[model samples]
Target: MTDPNEVDFAHTDAADRKRREKATGLARYIWERDISGAELLDLPDAQLRKLAREAGVNPPSTRETWTVVAELLDEKSRWAAAHPGHPQATPTHSDEKIMWIKRPITPWT
Candidate 1:
């Protein structure tokens, strides 16, 4: 059996990968929904953190634009969950959407 005290670098690596996946997922969701980061900035810090948690990612204690986007998505998700009876409100925000697009989409182009 492996020593209990021995740290598992593999496990740590896996966890890091998971966190990155969650962060990426959160970013994609935000973009698809067209939620505004500025609106997320309007929410309280606790609420912002809540969004990160709901997204299965840990947000930094300090605020950031990506965190704000995650928070906005979480807020909308919570609202939808709370009001299942109500028709889902359009998530499209009037404010400009934050662009977090990854580079090198079309290498051949």
Candidate 2:
């Protein structure tokens, strides 16, 4: 006989895990590409919601896509200001990208 509480807890845990995975995937997508605000605007609401979650914006369910994009960009700018040395903190210009390519890659432990 399984306890109902345990089953509910297990379901909640699974959902949380799934949400985390989606957020991670979205973050990776953003990091690997130079995505513009227009591109983000084209994304579905569900994807924007996931990106909002990853950006720590916590956009309301009733918010429009443009509103969410604005918030995400604002949060990204704040993060870049706070962590200027981080690789993905800001978008690199072509010259900067060349410089980045010339720099040696450090392996993470």
Best by lDDT: 1
Q: How do the residues 4-101 of candidate 1 rate in per-residue lDDT, one tens digit apiece?
A: 99997635878556555665666545544455455556657776566567556676445544564566566666676688677554444424343322
lDDT of 2 by residue, 23-90 (tens): 44444444334454455565677766665565565543543434444445556667777998998775
What is every candidate's alpha-carbon RMSD to the true fold? Answer: 12.0, 14.2
Note the residue pairs that clash in candidate 1: none
Q: Give Cα-based local distance difference scores for all models.
A: 0.56, 0.52
Over 4 Å off in model 2, which ranges? 1-11, 36-41, 44-77, 91-109
Error of 2 at 100 (Å): 23
Q: How far is candidate 1 from the true structure (C-alpha RMSD, Å)?
A: 12.0
Cand. 1 Cα-lDDT: 0.56
